[model samples]
Target: MAAEGKINPMHQFTINQIGPKLEIAGYNISFTNSALWMVLALVVIWLFMLGGMKRELVPGRWQMAVEGVTGFIRNMIDTNIGPEGRRYTPYLFSLFTFILISNLLGMLPLAIVPGFHAFTTTSHFSITGLLALMSFAIVLVVGFWRHGFHFFALFLPKGTPAFMVPVIIPIEIISFLVRPFSLLLRLFVAMISGHILMEVFSSFIVNGLGSSSAIGFGVSLLSFVFIVGIGALEILVCALQAYVFALLTSLYLNDAINLH
Candidate 1:
């Protein structure tokens, strides 16, 4: 239920058509706010990467920032997946930066500017699920391409007793299958929950302030404090979730590469 003059928290997650809707071959491929944000994220990433292309002896702020993020991802890959991981640095770097930027952009107070609203794409499972599936697909392709049928051996550890093969293999297989869903839900739920908290508090502040009683003012003040605190925490969650996603992805790739 929604109160009058109060915006629904979940309204932020709604997908709206950006232009005229179009149907082709029984498929609806109309452009949407989500699609626009994804494209915008990619453009932002490209511009950010341009910062590193200058290759100067004394790096400027932009260059240093780009190098810092690149080095961070490189170090993470090296630590998790070893030298072979170097090859995957570009992909993982893009993945981390995209998610980080998108999450941060969603937190922008754009709604304050009439007709402009910040939308978080990661809050949707479809987007996160696609990212997870892409990573999982890479793992599968690499595992099979390098090891062929030996990839199935991932389900059985080296030290498992022969008698426990049935139980251990099934458990491991199930766990392996659940990886994508875990990745999807972790990001989707985290992003959505934080936004919802902020929105709910925002509504409280607005509704409370509109009332004339002292209790209303007190409630409004408290809600404002909560919003500020939650906003700060949400910023941290944005970066942390992106890092966790990249880290888990690299670890999963390590399993495929090392078979351990």
Candidate 2:
């Protein structure tokens, strides 16, 4: 139980070790809550994907949903990356589903269950950082592969003043380098901020009941209503963030593929 006199809103984000740590070579890797949640999120995603596999004359709701998502991503890629982007469906689709599930899972009130709670992987910088790096790597590898050494030319745009080449080149290079960091911060901050607000309001409910006063109870009721609204907003944020991440990813791929 939480301490009687104080509530630690940040405590929910803690990563607890679930069992004995194992050493592989010189490094110790302990299974943790964050890792457990990630596995759970993947399982949920896998089950949902299986929903798309039912072959029938009339499609079920699950199959329709799966088809809808598939079409949306396909259209997004075509609009953003053109025909060549078709080759990237597997990566883009997986990215969208993983982040989408991870965000939604974190919004669930499952903390009461032992060894389970919504672990917002996107909120953790480490996870986001790794994703950002992978995105960057994809862009770098594909850019160079397609255009050879000319990929370096992306740093300088056409029609620029010859005299400003040095300044503009470095600036563009810095901006390109910052794409992953930008992606990392946008999703991480949104997830963390929304969850923190939910946590704070939840504590208000506890503190309200403890007071045993009419005004406290009334305020607690108000907090409850507000928290519900926040929860709905967080749900919207989950979908929006996932879409934005995928959209930005498509844009990045366009830049890499066409140097736009």
- Global Cα RMSD, each model: 1.3, 1.6
Q: Per-residue lDDT tens digits of candidate 1, residues 1-260?
A: 25577678888899999889899998999999999998888989999887677999999999999999999999999999999999999889989999999999899999888767899999999999999999999999989988999999999999999999989999999999999999999999999999999999988888898897799999999999999999999999999999999999999999999896
Whole-model lDDT values for every prediction: 0.93, 0.88
Model 2 misplaced regions, further than 4 Å: 113-116
Supply the TM-score for candidate 2: 0.95
Model 1, stretches more than 4 Å misplaced? 1-3
**Worst 10 contiguous positions by lDDT, candidate 1:** 1-10
lDDT of 2 by residue, 1-260 (tens): 26867667777788888899878998879898899889988999889989886966799999999888888999999999999999998888888889999999898888779755667888898988888788889999999999999998889898889999989999999999889999989999999999889888888898898899998899799999999999999999999998998899989999889985
Residue 214 lDDT (model 2): 97
Measured against the true structure, the TM-scores of the candidates, in listed sequence, are 0.97, 0.95
Clashing pairs in 2: none
